[model samples]
Target chain A: MKKKKKRLSLMRKRMFAGYLFILPWLVGFLVFYIRSIFQTVQFSFSEMSMDAINGGYTLTPIGWENFRYAFLEHGSFKQTLTSSVMNMLVDVPLITFFSLFMAMILNKKFPGRAIVRAIFFLPVILASGAVVDAIAMGEMMMQGGVSGQMQEMEASASSAIAFDIDYLISMFMNLGLPAKLLDYITSAVGRINDIISMSGVQIVLFIAALQSIPSSLYEVAKIEGATGYETFWKITFPMVMPHIITNVVYTIVDSFEQSEILKLADTTTFDMWNYGLGSVFSLVSTIVTCIILVVVVGFIQKRTFYYN
Target chain B: MSMKKGRIKKAFQDPYQRMLLGNDIKKFALTILQIAIIVGVCYVILSPVIGMVVNSISGDKDAYNPMVFIFPQYPTLERYKLVMLRMDYWPTITKNVLYVLTLTLIQVLVCSMVGYGFARFEFPFKKLLFGLVVVMIVIPTYTIKLPLYVTFRNFDPLSIITAIKGGPINLMGTPWPMYIMSLLGCGVRSGLYIYIFNQFFRGLPKEIEEAAFVDGAGMWYTYFNIMLKNASPAVITVTVFSLVWQFNDSFFSNLFLVSPDIVISKKISTLASVIANEDKILNVTLQELYLHAGIILVLLPIILIYLLLQRYFIEGVERSGIVG
Candidate 1:
């Protein structure tokens, strides 16, 4: 009885220490995150106006008017939301597949692999916030004068060397592929830049997953006379299944960050100064994202193989 | 020559040798195809950056000349000099770098602590708390931007400031909001950093902790002296990520209205307008050349850091156990 009591005290002590370790984050989470989320929810249901008297804004409780405005009255909210969701649906699978494929290739022994890997991760730096904005600004400015003509010439030259998408579409049409599948493929090709830029972190995650898969498994497969394709199917794919889910979630979140809806919300609040409507926009998107995330992650989690 | 030809014929005639030769040829072809694909993708990724570099160097004559496509007939450093001066590049970059580095350090420390707590502890509501971390990651910053901005703008915590100072403090246009957020482990992508550290810590054997306990080291001592040192992979991963994200971050900076002089990324956006107003060089195309130079200037420090840490960063990611 005494020994059990001592053990209980020890457990309690350890738990206390754990809480101590997490105290800073817990405080921040409660103070910053939870309060912000709560206020945002409250804002979505209220009208906010500048309080000239007290200097801070006042939130007057109004029912679902903001949400109604967002859903029914707002011109671009619905379109942006749907398009962003659709983009996510299209992007997630493509990014997952492309990153995994790249990761597999990158994991192999090759000369200048370090350089290639570094080059692949370049987007994580360059395609991020202000750099991309600045580059786009430059590109927009370049589109008016001599550079525009130069760009046209360069595009034609590249398309001549590269297989034209139009030619490929015609060839595939003659070969009688499904129109929907062809549309998907064409869209994927069109957004190839977006896909490559977004897949940097996903590729890193997949590479980590690939590297963590024990070489012993592959040796055993080889010993059993399995071919490369067989070995990949039997060992590699299932082993990396868990990371596919992580990458999918990551890609979805990333896409939403870059989505038009978030930008619309930003404009609504900061530019338009419609705080209630902006809150509604963000809240609806967040809830939709949560639903999609739960559904997709739940689906993937079912099939995810946990090796240990 | 006759003997060599006979040997080749003999090898070709053997079924095993023929199959081996065929497999080798297939492997070689696959390798060539893979290289082509990699090279193509790399070119696509790099082309825009190359374009920016080329444009930044192009002289006024080259900017207007239709013949200068990828390369400039006459390259000049004049645009860079003007941009550097107008953008206040040196002072702004130094301030931004300091801000980013400090934030990165705080994020690593606080996140690793929180992650270690989640990873090693058997506390009440542990699962629920960790779920909040996941929620933190999932919830877009836009969702909370308005409230967060208001909260910081007023800067009152539980009526403490309100009671003492008779009103709330406005933290907008200052670095305090970012510092406070980071110190409290709520900075940009802090959830992801915590998750990485948690995953890494959980992967470590429990034996280490037990041994430390047996050696009479307290939890804090063991954590600071032992576990953290052993978590270099997670540290490096978190450090690089935090640095890059914080450096490129416009969301939080914009939300808090952080001064353009403090966040150099914010300065890039206004560079063109600033140049136009200050220099009276109102030509959009000419102003664009300066903007490209400014972009290159912003990218230079980050690219340099990435190059220096690329090896360790890649290795860190591989071993950080972020896959789970």
Candidate 2:
């Protein structure tokens, strides 16, 4: 009877120990992350006071005007959003194809594959904060007439492309139905840069997944007199489908830099010092994020999750 | 059948049979195509970085030409030296970085250790606790920033041994805020490392622990002595990831530290802040030097760590299935 009582107490002690292990994260989430979201949502519907005179914390509650401004009034917000998304559309497919294509090439026996891999991987290093900025600075210097070689080329190139999106839009309008449709498609693509840049991480994930497929599967296919194309579609492609779905979801989660909605929220918080407004904007973005997860991930999971 | 025999004969009769086994002619063609395509890929993707590296080392960088060839006629390390000094060499650079990293390690350690306990042990709300861990990932940084700000602002909770650190310390400007945040296993991303730990720890073989149990070892003893040591690869992966990530984030660094002025304007001096404020970068011929210095300072740790633990750290992140 005493031994049985001791065992019961031991179980209780072990349970407490388990809680202690996870305590730091639990404290962190409660204090900061989870609470912040809740606070933002609470603050959203209220009108915020920004009176510099009184230095009061917040004021009366406001309504849906903030959302209205973000969605409708701000042309710059719209432009930045379109540009980001457009860049993503072109970027995601192009990056994925290139990285995978390059990985396949590197995986093969080659004299200079290592050198090539090193060169390709250099961008990841360079893209970090300071290096990228320096690089940008150098480009600015080059364009500002420091370079003897590039001076004429920069001039000629700028003249040729003239990169005016509005002008291109005008040209599309002239092209009639087909061009207009193309323009619509491209602009629609341009709204989500988050998807594009995040594709880099996904590309790496896919490459890893591709390499994991047993060469034995391909060997078997080849034994049956199968061609490389058939092996790719049947064996290599299907095996890596799970990875593709995971990477896509991962990309959406990362969202890298702040989105337009988040940016608007930042302006409210930091720029205007309207914590209430900022919080509301954030709540809305978080909701948007959940909706995105539901649409993209939910669908993908239903289709391909059986492989898991 | 005769048809199959005819097909085999036709296959044997083909003149271009060398293509199948990488015959020199076909291999040569493929190699050439691969090289060309690879070059294009390199050019499009790496131009900015390549351009920067080339331009920085170039003797004629005063011309600031982005299209210079790979080799500089007059190579310079002058920028390298200058950039290093400006980025705060000692405690601020190394100290802040190291402090945050140590915090991350402890955070991950506690998290995974706890995670291991929860995964393998039976406790109240075992399922409920695991559910919370999953929920932790989806929570955004913006949500907790204010409450965190308040928590860190609370002097008593954080300031028990104020004299211990020789200042009336609040958690805000120092590494404490970052430390406390990472302690919970949430870095820049949504609980990536902690999630990784849970995912990885759950996969560890249970037989080892069972043996420990038979030997009458406590769960803690089995975990630390047996399972923890056995889980070396994952531990390495999580450590390297948390180290690299916590080190890289400028956002929280920007958020946490208010300059002595303790205003938003002053706090805006984090590396990201400085980069964005272009007007502040003194545009003397010194800009090149400053630019070079900044890149070196930012990249040196990464490059140095990459070289020193090149085998372990890089492979760890890659194997952990995270981006390197």
Candidate 3:
């Protein structure tokens, strides 16, 4: 009875220590996260303009005016939001699947695997906003450089390549593929390079998950005379389900945040000084992304089998 | 029938030929397919980087030449010189290096503490608090950008300072926003790091901590000396991740580090405009070669760091304890 009481006290002490450690995060959550969320919602419904006299923002209450403008008056706003959603839907699955496939292949013992893995992971380093912006600027300047005549030659050369691409695309179209399907396929083919770059983190995460699965499970399956296909479904697939959820959640957030159309909203708000309208744009996109995340993650969570 | 019999006899005579008839042939085909994909993807990821390098060194005359794509015909340091002069690389890089290192160090220490707290101990509302951390990871920064900006602009927390000063204290145009956020466990990808650390700590055997508890060591002593010493893998993982993220991060820095020349990213961002203005004044024609060279130069440090720390970084990724 005395020992039990001591154990209970020890537990209480440990709990106290836990709160002490997390105190900073708790304070931050209140000060930064929750407060910021409320402010965003409030600012979206208000008119905020900078006062030149004191370099301060003057806010006038305007009920849903920004949101009304975004939904009804702002033509490009709705279009951009829809296109961003569509892009996320398409990009997420492709990225997740491709990363998993690559991770599985790279997990095997093979010649030059280390180099291949490094190549796959290189994008995580280069995907920084600075590098990406620099590359974008460089490409723009390269095309818009002093040699207009040279650009003309390059354009013609690209057009020649385009003709061959069109020919190959037509071959698929000849098989009675839908026009939309053909377009998506052609675009995806063009962006195959981008897909590889974007999958670096996901591939790394999946490879880590794959490596953590005990080999004993596989050995057991083999002893049971399970084929490779069966072992994958019964063992590897189930084992990696939690990682799948993690990857899916990651991919969803990443795609929505970095979508091309959403970047338009960024330029519109910050660059064009339409802070109210921009807030509405961001809030709407964020809400949609959250809805998708809750649905997908909840669904995957139900299926995930936890070992511990 | 006679020809079939002859073929069977030949197959029996040559075991190597016979091996190709069924599963062996399928395995061979699968191996070829796997290699093709690995090589193809590598090429796709590599070509742009290679293109960047090759074009950065090509002379203006060669860069304009239609025939020069992968190879530089007349390699010269002219573009590099122009880029170096335009970017003011040395001072800008040094400043950014200092900022990244300092910020990264703070984040690594603070985030590890938070993660350890969540992972190793139990407390009231622990589940709810950790859920908030997960939400922090999920919610896009844009949703909170305005409020965060406002909060930083005022530079007051919990309204205590506001009550004292009777006005907003502006922290804009200073590094305080980054320092505060990082210290508070709300910096860039802090949630992810905390999550990684939490997973790692959970995976560690409980016996080690139990042993420490029995040895009459205080929690701080155990955590600082024993627990941390045993957690070298997680430390390396978190450090590399924090350093890289902080270095690459421009979103928060762009908002707070409003000084155009304080950070490398900020400088790179304004490079085009700076050059355009230079063109208007200096009468020197600016072209894409300088821009390409500048981009390569910006990426050079990161590339070097990654290559140097490849072993530790890869090990971190492989053994981060983020398993199902």
| Least accurate 10 contiguous residues by lDDT in model 2 chain A | A188-197
How does residue A21 of candidate 3 score in lDDT?
82
Query: Which lDDT tens digits does candidate 3 get at residues A46-141?
Result: 989888788878889899899888889986877878888888888888888889999999988797776777788778878887878876665555
Error of 2 at A208 (Å): 4.6
Docking class of 3: acceptable
Q: Can you give the lDDT of residue B251 in candidate 1?
A: 82
Report the lDDT tens digits of candidate 3 across residue range B194-299.
8766655664557777788898988878777866655555565566667777877888887775454556666676666677687542222235566667777876
Instruction: Output the better candidate (2/3) by lDDT.
Output: 3
Task: Tell me the tens digit of each residue's lDDT in model 2 across B1-324.
Answer: 998677556656785643443465576898799889777666545554454565456554544544545666668776555444444454345554556457656765766775676566677777765555544554555556666666667545555556576545466777666665665666555355555445445544466676788999987788788776655544654554455555555557656773322221121124333443543654433355346445545555654553453244234323333210
Candidate 2 positional error at A84, Å = 6.7
For residues A153-233, write the lDDT of model 1, one tens digit per residue: 568746754566787789999999999999899778867877899999888767666665656677788899999899988
Q: List the candidate numbers ranked by DockQ, top first.
A: 1, 3, 2
A277 in model 3: Cα distance from truth in Å?
3.4
Q: TM-scores for all candidates?
A: 0.87, 0.69, 0.80
Which candidate order results from sorting by lDDT in descending order? 1, 3, 2
Q: What's candidate 3's i-RMS value?
A: 4.3
Q: How displaced is residue B284 in candidate 3, in Å?
A: 8.9
The model with the greatest TM-score is 1
After TM-score superposition, the amount by which residue A211's alpha carbon in candidate 1 deviates from its true location, in angstroms, is: 3.8
Candidate with top DockQ is 1
Error of 1 at B81 (Å): 2.7
Q: Judge the docking of candidate 2 as incorrect, acceptable, medium or high.
A: acceptable
